[model samples]
Target: MDWQAHARTLAAQIVRPESRWFEPLATTPRHTLVPRWWDSVDGQWALQDGARDPGRWLDVVYSDRTLVTRVGPVHADAAAPGTVVDGLPTSSSTLPGLVVQMFQHAVIDDDTSQVLVTTGSGYGTALACQRLGEQRVTSIDIDPNLVATARERMNLLRLRPDMKVCDVTGKLPGAYDRIVSTVSVRPVPASWLALLRPGGRLFTTIAGTGLIVTADKTEDGGAVGRVTPDPAGFMRTRQADDYDNPTREVWEKAQHADGDSVSVSRYPLLYVPDSWAVMSMLALDVPGIDHRVHEDGDQRTVWMLHPDGSWARATSGGFLEGPTVHQGGPRRLWDALERIRNRLNREGQLPVYGARVTIAPDGETTLSRGGWTVTL
Candidate 1:
């Protein structure tokens, strides 16, 4: 397959014609970085090998979609054929368009400016290297194996950037003029501000939501900015080999028990992750809600479980119908969600995007807009 031609075609579709990133997107070979990945099949992850089906491989690689490269420390390249892992995704090659959008947010105009990016499959790092030389780009990942693999793949294309294995929340290897994270983080890391040069900019998403913050370093060792109008979401940053799996005991209880309260849902069932504004508001107000959905024929069931022993299960026969909800524990999970929905209905939209953001020296982030305020 003519991968360069395919990349050019993809570049034309995704990159703005007048943008400086068009040439970089056109020339980068994404297939080299993502030779194997995982695909979700029936709510489970299935390995997809590019060498096994080159035609399908070329199609998926050139298309605008995220390719899951690792799930619970199982890199797709090392997995056997037909291997299926029932765990959350640990790393991925983010969609090319989103990467370009993030770069655009960073406003990398001068070639002399140094930038630090999160290395996934090294695809985004390759784009950065193409625009600014390898000397100006540094990419890091928490997984040592992923960093090594990405370094090897980039070598195949003769595109080398500084690749390091370092936890994003910890101290960085060097100072940078711009820090752009493709992974989500909670309570903007103070290390980022300390490592960034004065007048440097940082772009990242809030954990569990699509809130994209773009802040420039301030003189007071803090940063002040606003959430971008555009929404972007990414997997949370992990410090260990793998994220902790949900406790089986908590899952069993949330799945079977009818708790302290039972009532009819005031609003239709909502999968909070689907909506940018709704998810951002809910995640900020009541963080760490594990959501799951099940569908059997005409019936659909939605479950919301919290680590704090709060759980809510709602079932409905159709999309428009209200769900019968059962709640247990100290907090009413469904009631909190309903209140947010009600507020959204009243205000027409949640003021998460474009909200003014203030980050203190101690990593406290305050987001405010209109008359609402939330501090993390």
Candidate 2:
């Protein structure tokens, strides 16, 4: 297959020819790096092998979309045909557009600037290595198998960077002038601040929110920056092969039970997952909400569960009508959401975006925009 032609098409679609990232995206073989992936078909895992059908493979690989390379602990490369497993996505080759966005946010401008990048499918690292010399990039992941396999894939492309297996929140492999993570982080990491040079920038999305934080290191080892107007949602960093859902029982109980108190909500029964802005603001205020949606015939139900034994269920007529809200446990999860949504509707915007962020040397983060401020 003429992969270069497809790559060129992808580059043109996402960037201009004069852009610094155009040539790298136009030449890198994403198909070679991610030959197999899983596509969710009817909520079930469906494996897609590139070699089995070169046409479909090149079409998907060259497209500006994320490809799931692993679910739970099952890597697509190792899964048998028609194999199905129930688990969340553990790793992926992030969409080329978002990869470029993350790198561009960090301003990885020079070949001499040492960069630290998160390694998932390693396609992102390839782009970074292409932009900055291979010796200038250090790639890391929590999974050893991923690190090893990605290293092998890099050699196949004649692009070798420093690849290692380590939890991104812990001790890093080396100091860097720039750090860009494809994974989400919470409160930021002190290690990142300690490792970055003064004036060096760090870019990452906040956990449970699509907010992008761009902070530059200060001389005192802290960083000050703002939540850029970019929206990105990446899986959070994991310390193990798979993630654990601690709020499953709370969801089960909340899903079928009548609430301790029931009333009509002032808002419609909107699917929380589909509303990024509302979901993000709620996450900042409430945090750790396990959102679930169920639709039956002409009725719809939205379930919000928290590990704190708090659960809220809202049933709607599925016709833009207000929902009957039922809430239980220590906190009123839906009530908190409504409060945030109320502010959004009242003020045309939320403070989570374009908010100035101050990160202490210990990774304590405080975000402030105008009179609104929050600590996470």
lDDT of 1 by residue, 313-364 (tens): 8898987888989998778988988988999999898888889999987678
Tens digits of per-residue lDDT, candidate 2, 319-348, equal 668899999999998889889878988998
For model 1, state the Cα shift of residue 315 in Å. Answer: 0.9
Query: Model-by-model lDDT, in order?
Result: 0.89, 0.90
Highest lDDT model number: 2
Q: Give the poorly placed runs of model 1, Cα more than 4 Å off.
A: none
Root-mean-square deviation of every model? 1.2, 1.1
lDDT, candidate 2, at 298:
95
TM-score of candidate 2 on Cα atoms, chains taken together: 0.98
Superposition error at 185 for model 1 (Å): 0.4
